[model samples]
Target: MGSNPAAPIEVHDLTVAYRKKPVLWDIDFELPEGRLIGLVGPNGAGKSTLIKAIMGLMPLLSGYVRVYGQPLEDRRELVGYVPQRESVDWDFPVDALDVVTMGRYGRMGLFTRPSKEDYEIAMACLDKVGMADYAKRQISQLSGGQQQRVFLARALTQDASIYLMDEPFAGVDAATEKAIIELLKELKSKQKTVLVVHHDLNTAEEYFDWLMLLNMRLVKFGETRDVFTQENLRMTYGGKLHLLSEAAEKVARQ
Candidate 1:
């Protein structure tokens, strides 16, 4: 394997399965540092599965993932993950600030609590996402877009070099979407790499500098202008292997 020290994320022959059925097969790609990347594919395309595998949240059937030329476990602190907003329990009794402060928990050992400085850092993140005023509001009280911004703020507080966000634009207002794109640009300017799981093909070209096209595997990964063409998108969303389709369907049914 060519280990480029500058690449933020490197996957080699990665495979993941649910039960006995494969979800992602023989996936391999390296994400360049300091770019805003859009990971696009049709539903059930294993986009989120890929992010989950990278975060070690899901078991991998085979293959390995590296972060900054080292095993993922060794550089876990350098990776920040923003899961889908829907995956969270909104009703839990926590304000926006509390949620953001939780990001510091990884840096803070189990026995230590967040200090005043940590709270300041969380507030700064909230301000960066334009949610500083909502710090005291209950998470459930925020609008969909505001909730998403809060999540972004939480991820920002991690101060990670690389970020993996799953569908950050889903269910967000246009204003929130624009804000997120700006935040991504800011991250890129700071030499941080961000990979966003995005579904809207129309906005995909406009938002990202790099693109990762996946359909149960890596279809193409390169600069947006080169990889986001009609042919590659067709290959991603079009005809699938009957057996793989059937397996995915069966897994979904369960």
Candidate 2:
């Protein structure tokens, strides 16, 4: 599950496949509703696949995903998604504000234009992410971190209770990562649930309250402090090591 029902996103027995090959298997967990949760794993471990399946971005082999106690698709407004920075073209013509306004497109309903209120909400979301000054700037001109912030602002504009972010910190500098972490903390303060697909091992404990460790299957899901241990880290990133360490990594990095 993504987060608590009282909190934000939830998933049960989530299984996903790519081209008939299973990528995720029987993942079940509850995020602490309004807190930040981190999804950590090796490459090809299906971290991004988990969020995508939950978001209906692709079909799920089995399992369920809910936002605010309802199926996500039925209650789309209660959810927001920030895809990877590499997921889209930076050269696209859309400006920062224009991206944020997409959040309201759903609320505006099909075949209609945005209203004045939509603009206000989009501006507010941009401001929330500290990008109001660059609302009109083309995305290509921004740095990696700024671009990430803009994407986050777009998600915020949706005003959803749950946020699913894929590799939010992938290409950003430390300063940008810190800034984004701070913004996530602020979202927690507002009782919004956030799930981030994170790869950096160094900042795991410091940045997230909950962790979903995966490798094409649910390895472990619980409090970051309890679940993040020497043995687990060994299992999670051991392949990078040698001998016994490498073997453990093999079992974990399914």
Best by TM-score: 1
Positional deviation of residue 169's Cα in model 1 after best superposition, in angstroms = 0.4
Clashing pairs in 1: none
Q: What is the lDDT of residue 121 in candidate 2?
A: 90
- Candidate 2 has its poorest 10 consecutive residues by lDDT at 243-252
lDDT of each: 0.90, 0.82
Best model number under lDDT: 1
For residues 18-110, write the lDDT of model 2, one tens digit per residue. 898999988877667677889998788899988888889978889898765788778888888999889899999989888888888988757
- Model 1 lDDT per residue over 11-37, tens place: 889999999999999998888878899
**Residue range with the least summed lDDT across 10 consecutive positions in model 1:** 243-252
